[model samples]
Target: MIMRQGQQLLLPANPLFIWFSLIVAMMLNMLPVGRIPWMPDFLAVVIVFWSVHQPLRVGVVAAFLFGLAIDVHQASLLGQHALAYTTLSFFAITIHRRLLWFTVPSQALQVLPLFVAAHAIEIAIRMLAGGSYPGPTLLLAPVLEAALWPVVSVLLLLPQRRAPDPDENRPL
Candidate 1:
């Protein structure tokens, strides 16, 4: 893929690193902090990140499976997260190419709507399942996730930023 000017050339992402990061995000989400209404969904953010960065490897299926896991963990309605994550992954994949052209902050702005949509889907699903409203604070989750985008982009891209083989005469 042709890169934008001044964009750092990233090494091919390691499959192991990608999966490990996903697992770590999942574990973070599972932390027993009594799920706050405004708490950002870490797994959702990471899944969207990977979906945008490595769509071929971490697409809708992975999102669905992880969403199922989250649903089971949280004991929410079945497929609530699965459906939301699947949609999120689909949209992330759709925009991945254009998104890469933007700077990190700009990318965050671009993805905010995606995160909002994901949360909205989740809330809609919950309500349809006869669940109580999580309140106005729920609105904060997407914004928090968007705020986290740049940090996640930086950390997850670190492994791919290193030169495969450092050389005295070469600078990548």
Candidate 2:
């Protein structure tokens, strides 16, 4: 069924959009960093927006798969990105409802902390699992990812917040 513009689809969606987005994100990740290897993680930012706005459509499972893809592509420890993606998706999904109430600026505020905490977990897990944890540089992921979050979100139509309601604490 063709969903008209601005209307949310109530039925099962085709996998094309999700798969396309995932591929785009992965491709972006594959780009050479040149010198700044610590630049923002485009895939993580993309998945975070999807998880927040379309939690049912994108979740930890997708993140895990993407993580695996990145791990293989980058030849990192098998589960580094997988662990990071799963943890990031979990955080985004849990607070997604409230995020809708936030304006883009407020959403920025919400995302910054979420990104930091999520990456910290990934860094901690990577350290514990088997590899030598990179020093403080791991913390940079959140800073860079948060900076890119809104830009990534604009790639798609903004997902609807909760259905219209009176007395909502709308974003300021």
Candidate 3:
């Protein structure tokens, strides 16, 4: 019997889209909205997406750059976002393959821990940099980002949607 390889699919896979997503995410972070606690960390979400889909290319270096960009743009702390994002990307690249097996809800659950870890790290970095922030309200980002996992996943996956099937119009 002949062995068959999995069918290859077309995906955005372009570096431009990746960079665009990242920049958009960074802009969102500085939008000055979502002040009531628990705002979605758009940058984190984008990093999570690229980390999972393009782990080979989007690694600690990219994380470092993105984090640094956020740091410079927001003027929070030099390494606060850098440290958090780098740490998250490191872990995300490691478990991304395994995470692919999980459903959206389960993936959201998985993201929670990463989100928390990132938030904790960011807070720590801020403290280390001599900044005191609003207490627990600052922690809201993690939970919100975690809850947003599914939506972000979908958005990030959009450029990779499969070709329509012949029976796509038919209802189940």
Record all residue pairs in model 1 with backbone atoms less than 3 Å apart, i.e. clashing.
Answer: none
Q: Model 1 over residues 1-172: C-alpha lDDT tens digits?
A: 7877888888999999999999999999999999699999999999999999999999999999999999999999989999999999999999999998899999999999999999999999999889889999999999999999999999999999998899989988
Quote model 3's TM-score: 0.83
Q: Is candidate 1 or candidate 2 better by TM-score?
A: 1
Spell out the clash pairs found in candidate 2. none
Decreasing lDDT order of the candidates? 1, 3, 2
Off by over 4 Å in 2: 1-15, 34-37, 129-138, 158-172
lDDT of 3 by residue, 1-172 (tens): 2223542354557788888988888888889764454677889888987898799878889999989888897777788889899999999998998887678789989878998999888777777778776577767778788888888877767777655453667422
Tell me the TM-score of model 2: 0.74
Among residues 3 or more apart in sequence or in different chains, the pairs in candidate 3 whose N, CA or C atoms overlap within 3 Å are none
Error of 2 at 168 (Å): 30
Task: List per-candidate RMSD values in Å.
Answer: 0.8, 7.9, 4.7
**lDDT of predicted model 1:** 0.95
Residue 37 displacement in candidate 1 (angstroms): 0.4
lDDT of 2 by residue, 124-157 (tens): 7766877565667667767877777677666554
TM-score against native, each model: 0.98, 0.74, 0.83
User: What do the candidate models score in CA lDDT, each in turn?
Assistant: 0.95, 0.74, 0.80
Model 1 residue runs over 4 Å out of place are: none
